[model samples]
Target: RSAGVSKAHDPRHAAKMFKSAQEDKTGRWLAIHFTSHDNPHISRDALEELIQDMSKQSYRQEILAEDDEIQLSWLVYRAFNERTNKIDDFEIPKNWLVYVGHDFGGANPAALFVAQDPATGNFYEFKEYLPGAGHSTAQHVDMFKELTTGYSVIWRSGGSHQEGEIRQGYSSHGWPIVEPKINSVKAQVDKVVGTMELNKVFIFKSLHNRLTEVMNCLWAPDAEGIPTDKIKDEEKYHLSACARYLYCNFTPDTVVHNKSRTSHSMSM
Candidate 1:
């Protein structure tokens, strides 16, 4: 759990249960997912043509497939691709509204820092922190402080699989975190998808880890084989979770009003 409770009342409780049941060796559930690619009833040329179409708009194909994308496919797909969202040589505004997002699940927890262009209401992810296990909470806090030394950080938000971890752990450790109000992972993920599609948010080229996880993040199909909010190989998607948390908690009213320093950029 990121910083919250790990129990049944969670929004994504069904997905967690699905994955768990699939892994159980006691024969309670036998998960089998198949696609048209594996269908013996289709002709070779028809299959090839279908595969070509699927490649062009894989997201829809995943949902339509008979197996319902059991293997899963890229979550953000081409929407968040480098051609659309990656920015090089982005200048950090001397004065801007700052927001930090966290994800405590998975082996590699993630912290994403975003600075909003106060005037434009656009957000730029300039940095990321993935301090793996073995580091103390104070150490992580110090690192977070060092990363955001100058900017005025206005919001800190995130979620976890366990109850109270988000509300209790970080607050106790000097970092107060408020969980997102909308609990549906789909809604949060849709915000990220829309942002990437609209190019409202961009990631600096230097943030390799952040870009990598999101680019590779895929939507996992539920037991019915339809792509769901559950992510595929979630343990590797700490940054994706961070991005989801950031966009879900963002509001237009949080823009900075600093007139002292103007927006500026320098060579990295």
Candidate 2:
């Protein structure tokens, strides 16, 4: 710990400290590693202000623009390679893990590996994977086997054929397959939104491709900013659809009501 370095506990406090540091002529550099969440929404001015404040208050160091980018394969390797930390443990009370995927057929199939902690109501991670990575059905089977060894998975499809393929290929291997609950565009969007409200839906840190696909899917130029029918990115629509399916299946209210009425009728 450097001198005059006190931990700023809150975001506002951290921002104030940055300002304090920038004012210090002795500060020549500012090296910051953000372990906290980064939102793309923060304004440039706000970011600049924080940076400038830190530089001015403390002995500013070089402002380095470096980000640690981890991939899904790497994350999986890491997660399974060693005992997961309490922070990353999939078994944590608040945590729920699932996979949402789409197939482009012959092209790299897209997927989002999602995990949410119901206890904390925070998303652990939503990541993307290539279903076609292994080449043959055996390869896909292996990938699916590895991908879904221990978590609940939600799969989304444009149709049922792929589901059949998955069932035949992987279900026998004991890969848990939840039926893909198909929904229209508005319904799908609503499902995603509703899930987010009910529980924290965090995209896995490693799955940038899947995250990007879902975000892109939401960006169509119709319905005046409302998400429209035209799914510009088929991959995105498919993955997001999977996400909606997960929400629809698990959330209590969304779960289909058991219509078979049970009567405690005493037969005469």
Top candidate (lDDT): 1
Candidate 2, 1-268: lDDT as tens digits: 5899754422133444555675667767574554212545767676666665553212122233221121121121112211122122234232253444444345555444555443343444444556544376556557755766666553433324345666455456644354445445555555555545443354443554444443334233343323344555544445555555444444423322232111112111
TM-score of 1: 0.63
Model 1 agreement with the true structure over 1-268: per-residue lDDT tens digits: 3667564422233544566777899997886556665667878687676666443345344534422232224344446656556889566876877888888743566799988776666778998998877776667778888998877887777885454565576788877777764567777777677666655677898998876666556677555445666777766777777887777654323333443222222110
Name the Cα RMSD for model 1. 14.2
Specify the poorest-scoring 10-residue window by lDDT in model 1. 259-268
| Model 1 residue 244 CA deviation in Å | 1.0
Backbone Cα, N, C clashes tallied per candidate: 16, 35
